[model samples]
Target: MQDLIAHAPVLFPLLLALGASAGFLAGLLGIGGGIVLVPGLYFLFKTLGYAEASLMHLAVGTSLAIIIPTGISSARAHYRKGAVRMDIVKMVGPGILLGVAAGTVIADHLSGAALTIVFAGALLLFAAMMQIPPKVRDEGHAMTPVKGSAGGFVIGGLSSLMGIGGATLNVPFMTLNGVPIHQAVGSSSALGPVIALPGTIGFILIGLGVPGLPPFSLGYINLLAVCVIAPLSVVAAPYGAALAHSVSVKTLRRVFSAFIIIVAVKMIWEASHG
Candidate 1:
């Protein structure tokens, strides 16, 4: 607690900045912002001299916690626009729940270093994914219970491990499988909570009683970071969505791709050298 207070001069501003940037980027790119939040908080906490063993855990857990409110709002907005596919959400929901439960258990067993590698790998994957231009296609295969469950499991499990809301994976999966892009994006948004809710709880439960956690943390979820980032990100997302109408998403995506690759490499380098 004292350490956080002492560094408040430097850390608060950075947290605020991260929150705003995560929100803005989310709106602009149609992402969930876990890509921004996880790395951003990890480095920020690292600078504050928290325990190395828990830094990534803290980052991931708190990032999941922050997604809850923002994701709900996003889902609601999309639902109102008739963009959401509630049927898809149901088809995948059960598997996503099961997958998240397993993912949490897996995360709890891994060391922080391992978790960091996993997260960086996700960043690299998503960065590469974004670099590719969208391909036009006719209606694809039909969604089945088996396919939905399997895809949902993958999305939920990976998302839990990485503290993401799963849009990066979900949208692509949906689109590739013949869902329209708009409906896919909307369904992805709706599933954000499906991924986040249990994931957050899992982190919290697994983190309880762990030593060297930052102050104001509830298990792995840092309450301080969540409190600071959630509102700002929520407030900033609308503006970002608004800006999306005017900006060139292609250019923005290319720049973002470059940025994430850099973040991923830096993380890998730091892990190797640390």
Candidate 2:
């Protein structure tokens, strides 16, 4: 806690930069910024002298908290562009809630190292999938309840563990099912907050009474980090949404794949070395 305050002069700027990038990516990718925020916050918190045992947990929780506002902002921006698919969101909502419930409990029991490993692996798998074009490229059938809800349940569980909104999985699923990439990204943006809202609260409740937490923490959600990051993310998300609408679908996929690969490799290396 003392270390955090003393270094605020330097740390604040870094956090602001993180928030800016995160917000932009949230809009661009509909990932709720969790994929970026988890690793970034973990690095920042580690440097601030937080215990290793709790570093990833804290980061994940805080990332989820920041996603709530950013997701809303990005979703609204995408909605205005007529890219968001409310139909899909409605189909998947219930499964997301159920998945979050189970995933939170699982996360609470896993060690930080385990969580990092899971996060890294998920990033790698998703990135690889994005680079590979679907073989058929045919329009998929309408999303049935069985498939939509079931798939959403799985995405929700995985996302909860990774401190993400369901976008990493949602975008891929929607695109494979014949939805255009732009609409997939936009729809994912709307779905992100649904995962984040309950997921944040779940993390908070699970983290309570745990020792060695940083100051101003609500469970695993760090209020201090959220206060700085969420607002900036909210403000920047609209711009990202605009950019998403401007670029070619191929370009967007390329950017997302490359970025995730880089981040995943870095995180994996650090986790292995540590």
Candidate 3:
């Protein structure tokens, strides 16, 4: 704790910068910023010399912690614009809650390297899907609000394990199921908090009394990171949401997909080398 406190000046600023960028992306992409936050936290923790065994867990937990406020902020912005689909939220909420519980248990058992590999692989898959044309992607039956239970469970579970807000999966699912792309993005913003809150709590509970956590940590969640990141992310999220409403995002999606792929490859390399 002393060491972290002593380095607060340096770390806090970095976290704030990371939060700013994450918030913008979350709002813009409806991604809840977890995809960025997890990798950023991992790098920060690694620099601080946290044990490799627990580094990924801490990163994921902390990412989810920060996502709570950011998600709410982004969601509210979208809701104000009448972009969120409440019917979809209602249909998926219960299953997501259950899946989050299951995912936490799964995360608790996995090694950090294993978790990183899984996260990386999932990112790659999502990125690939993002590259597909919408017409080709939506060849199956049209999406109905009530038909999302199974997908919600799977997304929620995988999101919990990856310490994400479930946007990566949720957005694609919605879009492929006949939801308008913009509406899908908005709805995904709302889902972020749903996945994150339970996921954050689960990580905390799962890591309780576990060893090798860094300073200011509550179980696997890093309080310091959350404190530094959440406020900034919340403040910036609205701006991103505004941008999402104002801008054409087709180009942005492709760019973001490329970025995700790069991040995934980097994670895979790190996992393989480590």
Candidate 4:
């Protein structure tokens, strides 16, 4: 623990940067910072000399911990904009909880490289989704309950494994299914804690009694990272939400596509090299 504390100076600055970056992106894209934070933490952990095999899992779990607050902050910001659908949140929330639990089990068994590859693939898929043509013919209706349930499971599973809040997937999916993009992004913001709560519990149970884990660890979740990042993330998230309101939708879509592409390329490079 002393050794970990000794490293605090190094980690704290990085966490602060991560929080700011996430906040800006969350505001800009209506997506949580998980996509940014998880992969970035993977490399940070690897550099810190933790076991390569556990690094990505730790990153994912810790990202979830940090995202808990950011998501809530962003969600509230969107709620104030009248973008959230209570009906959708009510219907999807339980399915997400169940799926997150299942995904945590899968994460526990997967290899680090396998997880990275999967993450890389997910990023690529997000990039593709962002680039695709819009499919919405109407902008005021929600999908059927069955579609919502299925989407919830997918979002929950991916979020649990990748440490994402599913905003990347959710926003695009909702837009395609006829929800307005603003509302989609807003509602998607709330998913972070929904995914995090069950996933964090699962990681704790799985990581208990493990040997050679990093200091300040809680199962796969890292307290050092979470504590360092969460507060700033909360503060910055509303700023990002406000920014979301300022951008034109076309400009926002272009920015979102470009951002995912850049991130996807970075992930592919890291996965290939690491």
Candidate 5:
């Protein structure tokens, strides 16, 4: 607590910046901020002097905690724009829940290098995905239950493994398949819980028997950071969504992509060096 207090001056601003960046990207691109948050937390925790072995877990867990609130706030913001597809969300929820559990278990076993490699791959893939323009299908609007479930599985697994809320993966899939941006964002927002709930639980279960875990850590999740950062993020998320209506998303996407690239680099650096 004393160490955290002394670092508050630096950590608070860092958290705010992270929250703001997350909101902006969520509003602009329909992503859940995990792409940025995970890598950022990795570096931040390292800076805070956490041990190497426990550092990535803390980063992943803490990232999940913050997503709990950020997801809700961002979802509401996009929902108000009538972009959410509730039916689609409902159809996919079951598969997503199960997949997240599976993914978390897989992640719990991987080393930090493996995790960093996965994150880097995701970032690169996302960058490529953005560049490839979506070609909306001219077919029927309704998606099949089987298809939705399959999509949910992918979203949940990737999100849990990467410690994301599946937004980054969700939005492009929807847009490419003919779903509108607003609906994609709203629906993806709801998916966060499906990912976070099981993922967080998985981390806890895995971390329980491990020795030398960080102080005040629950499995991998850090309650202190989550409690402090999530509230503001929740509030900020809606504001970002509302503001998105007026902003230029094209510009936002380009800048956001570059920002993600930087984070990827940092994570890779740490995984190799520390």
Candidate 6:
């Protein structure tokens, strides 16, 4: 606690900046801001000389904790615009819950290096998919939904493991299935809490009694980081949603693709070297 207090000046500003950036991206892209938050938190903790064994877990946990409010704020903004598809949320909710539970278990057992690699790999795949333009289908027509709960389960599980809000995968999946881009983004924003809430609880439970956590931590979730980041992110989310409504879909895809690629590459390199 004393050490954290001593570093408050530096950490608080960084957390604020992170929250702002993450919230904007979440609203703008229908993402939960985990793609940005996980890596940022990892770097910050690493620099602070946190133990190698727990750093990535802490980062992932803290990111999910922050996403709860951030997701709500972004989802509400999109909902107000009539962009969210509650039907899809309802369809996938059960599968997402199961998958998140499975993912949290997987994450808890994995080493920090393994988890980092998984995050990087998933980001790389998402970035690649984003770079490809979605095929346009007949107006009001969408691809047949994949049968069963498998798709939702996979999405939810992958999201939990990566400590993301599932937007990176969900947006693309919905868009590819013939959902309108805006609707896809909006629905994905709504999915954030579905992924974060259970995932956060899982992490906290799994990490309880574990060693090497930073100060002010509850299980793997860092209270200090959550407190610092969540409010700023919530405040900034609406602006991003407004931007999403204003921007061209093509432009948003291109921008998000580029951003994810860079982050993915950086994480991959760091994992390899570390």
lDDT of 5 by residue, 100-130 (tens): 8778877888886777778777887787666
> What TM-score does each of the candidates earn?
0.97, 0.87, 0.88, 0.86, 0.86, 0.87
* Predictions: Cα RMSD each: 1.3, 2.8, 2.8, 2.9, 2.7, 2.8
The per-model lDDT (C-alpha) reads 0.89, 0.83, 0.84, 0.77, 0.73, 0.83
TM-score of 1: 0.97
After superposition, candidate 2 runs with Cα above 4 Å error = 27-32, 133-140, 240-262
Name the candidate, 2 or 5, with the larger lDDT value: 2
Q: Which stretches of model 3 miss by more than 4 angstroms?
A: 28-30, 133-146, 238-256
lDDT of 4 by residue, 79-142 (tens): 8989898777776777788788888888888877888888878877776665575565464565
Candidate 1: how many backbone clashes? 0
Candidate 3 per-residue lDDT over residues 47-109, each given as its tens digit:
877789898899999998888887787789889999999887877777788889999999999
TM-score of 2: 0.87
Name the lDDT of candidate 1: 0.89
Winner by lDDT = 1
Each candidate structure's count of clashing pairs: 0, 0, 0, 1, 3, 0
lDDT-better candidate, 3 vs 6 = 3
- Residue 18 of candidate 5: its Cα lDDT? 71
Ranking by lDDT: 1, 3, 2, 6, 4, 5
* Model 3: how far residue 49 lies from native, Å: 0.1
The lDDT of model 3 is: 0.84
- On TM-score, the candidate that comes out on top is 1
User: Which 10-residue window of candidate 1 scores lowest in summed lDDT?
Assistant: 133-142
Q: After best superposition, candidate 6 residue 232: deviation in angstroms? A: 1.0
